[model samples]
Target: MSTLGQRFSRWMQSRTLTGLTPGPHDITIRKDLRVPMDDGVDLLADLITPIGETDPRLPTIVIRGPYGRRGPVAGEARALAREGFPVLFQSCRGTWGSGGVFTPQVDEQRDGLATHRWVREQPWFTGSVATFGPSYMGYTQWAVAADPELAPDALCLLVTMPDFGAITWDNGAFALRNALGWTQMMDRMIRRDMLPLGLAMIRPDPKLGRAFGVLPLSDGDTAATGRAVHWYQDWVGHERLTDEYWTQQSHTASVPSVTAPVNMITGWYDIFLPWQLRNHAQLAAAGRAPRLTIGAWGHTSRGMGGVAVGEAVAFLKEQFAGVPSGRTALVRAYRTGEEEWHDLPAWPPPGVAAEAWNLHADGRLSTEPTAGGVTAYVYDPADPTPAVGGPSLLPNSGPVDNAAHESRADVTVFRGEVLTEPVTVAGEPVARIQFRSSQPSADVFVRICDVHPDGRSMTVCDGIRRVVSDDGFDEVTVSLWPTFHRFDAGHRISVQVSSGAHPRYARNPGSGSPAFDAVTLHRAEQEISHDEFRPSFLDLPVWAG
Candidate 1:
């Protein structure tokens, strides 16, 4: 084992089980089992079995991931094992205690199929299996499900989206600023040494190292250190949105071939919300049994405490109980002061209607139709509007606060009159815009919020559109992620339109140059239209919920 893995194992042994407490019945834990792949690479796995002398074979849940297989999914595996399901937590071919160099999702497809095949041949195999996890783990489940020979009985995907190009590398852009930090952390593991790399790269303080269990980067010539640098450079070199490189790497192209029943779980505040919705839509449209559940939480919130573990357990039970009926059971829960879970036959709800709110000349949003007039705003890239609230990388709870950001002069705030009745928007919020820019390119950011009577405004849904691809007088439709928000009586609906939402999304330099080295900024004269010919308006999915 690598030094870091050895240390982590010792720590787990000490913390997970103390002196002689009886372990759970119907579950036996075994670590460091080798499973050979088709490519002759032996992958390491930790198996959790439901002990039964007569029926050693039990329904299985396979969680194949790049993150330490023994780490993130440990809690879920233990919980599932206790529920009478054998959970196999396997490290990806080249991650953690596994043998090989980590190369992200490229190896996952073959390794996942091999792992499933190996699991079926085991003495404890029950001929029934399901794949589940979040993010990369979730993507692996989909990839394995796409394999014709290894189609699992069910797939429970959490917070993973379809199309790497659209979401993961949106138009060939990395969403998370912590990508570098994550790469560095993984590099340390690959080199078999846990050098306090992320902390050193971010803050470079030795004192902070103690808190994070990180050792100084100078401590050892860890393989992870070198891997991190290489990964960062590789990511930087690829700049085109639709290059042959990205086309071959994308896994969504295989979605049409997947036959396993899919259960997608996402969060409203997740950075990949839009992509998750698209995945659900595609799967459902392809005549597959697909279900979707979205909550008002971040990437790690559902596992931590925001949502109840029982909810996920119930979902799994439902999927494994019977064959999917080619029907979608859509549910959306919002953390609106308290948790509210609502069920619908379809996304956006069948009875729900689209309400168009137009931007008036006097900075007012209303249902009234306007004449041939336009609302204009000056976009200055030097002092762009700072990002506040929305689905960002920062570790926090509840909805994000964008009130302070609204005060900026550069941010154009358009507000509709307070609603006399409560209104709920439950689906994808779209902004149909007809605008002309003075420069060759510009970025348009739209934020939807519910303004309370007390003057507090909480963000609901937001979207961004890079106008560089658009012609001067072309109309564009920007679709914001779906949201569930209750606009109380006397509370108004507002849209904060601006040029940029920095950091959350890399600032569009407006130079019509490459994403990496393009630093030149151009001023633009933007004109927003709301009329019959160029009927630009915000389409809010008004739901009864």
Candidate 2:
């Protein structure tokens, strides 16, 4: 087993791995591992192991997901198996070859437990097991970890969340585009399973564009996917986090029961970055120091120019042997602008200072606060501000230059002077604004950017908030997800204020009614104020070192 120190030393010495190399041992594949569940339904899996060994059992790594057992997972299973680590690629119920209906987010806990139990009973099991995968597959690890009897020895999770709401709803606004896209993907999986010959490709949804514009958000699922996704309908119908439906499906409900070492992998632009942070915090609070790795990429690509498998493999090796990870930091984040990775002994590190930049009349952001200034913008849902990109899982995700969008009159832009010195930030930025709107309800979308000397606005991180209006000036606070970035000298800090990140978040409708049933669209006149009474400011987390 390799400790964290030993692994980091090796990683620092030679960081030139293209893809994981398989071990010298010839491997054999078993296409059917029928894992019986409590309900008597068998979940199907493909098992990969060393060809000739049968007496000395090997460690197991189970990747149970709704994704098919043979498609995306076969290569991964082969590679891990080649390295002497046997892998079980299991399919979630009703999709691929698994039994029972496929209701997303439900049945994962029990199904995961059953599969793990079956693995331990097999002769090839070394009595040590770990769970791995991204998205819902990652959830399977946590689900089983919650069960003391079935919990894996370790967990290697990637770009996934412990709860669905964090992906579909953030700060009170519905995540329209992500929810629709994901539902469509799952719907296609089921149809393809039934008609493999004809449904070669998930036929494009003709109602896609108009579907997003549907009056009732709840009914938009069938319009977009051309089929009924019951879980999605349930998602849009129950908008409250307080709903019993969500509470029962939430994976965090099992956090206290998870005692295994966990390696949490996520990207800066990953849709569930915020939720991953929440998971890290909850684990720490439970007295578990899980390892974390954040990079500068989106949901699909772990990192554009970097690979994480080496570190992940090392982490798993340590866990499987019941060996300590050794002295180390909790966070290992790749700073975006700097294009470098740094280790923080603790998240937000120690001795971090909070610097405030006040918004002023000239669209200037500085330490000097100006008096009696108001900036206004018109928010039209039909012509709502589109998502420019920061954190998202939709078709158009990752970082896109926002200069063109910032040039629009509908966006209120505030910028600071070129930096005379460099500034490093390792946590979420906070925006406190005194706001007023013509309507009784509104949505506020905010972004923090790095204004290059050449005038290009590169987004660092962004956030959105849905406000139930008081019809007057009211203070609102929004927090961007935690980030690791540094603005070099001569770079300017910028803040953008707008009404909506349409399709990214469902348009607020401005009617103060149910978002789904909103028929009439109204334009809103919004104002951002800064003065003695209402001094609006953007809080930056500056690291001393």
Candidate 3:
């Protein structure tokens, strides 16, 4: 390696990837080796190995994803190779220089299994193997981990889940921005439009907002990219989780059966946190010891990537080289408001008690239930309530001040008194709204925020639920994302009730029609009752510890 390159690597380890020990070996990258699959189509992969290691003793690390094998992924491969592990970084089908047509999640299973088999058949096969990557690459790892015969020796998954269908239709509402934004991103990547892609990642395209506003989501793909994206359209068409298309696309059924040593890393603001935690829980329930680490970051946070790589290297070394993992606990999570890291035995640790905070008509939130009263708002599909900040694929993701959004007329705000003592929340926050809509179909978007003394209301966690109820009033439960936050003394806990979080979740047309084909917009008069008979409240997972 050149002196400059070596210096950069040392800087990255000491600063960005802190706590990880830099390796001594220099690396060589063997490019464009073809591995044949079940259908006789060859997938191109690059192998990175230590320069002096002709016979590699450590387990080979495999990374497969739709993203090209160069750039950040290649850097990770080289880092692993320098650590004395041979790394096979392969492009997914039809991506980069690979052969077969790309179909996202549908092809990962067969392709991953075939690649693992091919690795074992190679002359330099090390018998043991591991898979590592973040996001889509993590899904690729889960794709083959279910099969005991084909599963890798270890898996390092970051901010990803097995079921794409769940994220597509989270809380029974379409994840419009994330789903569509991801489609546009992959479209640009497949075309090798690096400049625009890089620009979009840094800041969302302003023109893309107009495309997202287009009626009938089937046209959204073309409007955003000037071409029809097959996967986006397919996702829109199969909005229901029970649909056969989504069933074929999901690999969640594989989680409990995975026998590999697993290390999962995610952020509280990450798109896949909830589902990934569920996967960890499933593995734990099945007697598998999967390690989980969560940070206070968004999907696109630079810190998230750095933490993932550092943790993954430690996990790989522990599994393959008999090295100490150096992990403090089975579950390590960073508490946001407190700004402290906690090592726990498990997620939501024991003794978390649920506290009900009642919502009053005069925008007051208290523990005491109010008498009969209701608050109403008008939600127009033509001018949907815009999303401020939360889990999203765009650059402006994670916790942002939501004061402006709360000031909007379409959203109802409920504020609690300034806290005299600190209140820590450690699990999922759920909202139960005794809701009624003028239209048969409507959506209820609920959010939890921490109001600082300076008047900044930063979003903590939120969720949306689409409802179609014929009953006069339905108690709709919206389960917000799990969070670990401390509302310090003098800070207030607030909640926002709205009909839509616009581009984050697709707007409900209020005409009892699917968002995919609904072009007719109807204004919805939504009501939330705080009546004793139909009490609406926010259930907080209050951690007394």
How well is each residue in 266-343 modelled by candidate 3, as lDDT tens digits? 899989988888888899999996999999877767666566777887787777776887887899999999999999
lDDT of 2 by residue, 464-497 (tens): 8888787678888988877788899999989998
Mark the regions of model 2 whose C-alpha exceeds 4 Å error after superposition: 1-17, 52-58, 193-207, 302-306, 322-330, 394-396
In the order shown, the candidates' Cα RMSDs to the true structure are 6.5, 5.4, 1.9
Please tell me which predicted candidate would have the highest lDDT against the true structure: 3
TM-score of 2: 0.90
- Superposition TM-score, candidate 1 onto the true structure: 0.83
By TM-score, rank the candidates, best first: 3, 2, 1
- Residue range with the least summed lDDT across 10 consecutive positions in model 2: 9-18
Sort by lDDT, best first.
3, 2, 1
List per-prediction Cα lDDT, in the order shown: 0.66, 0.77, 0.87
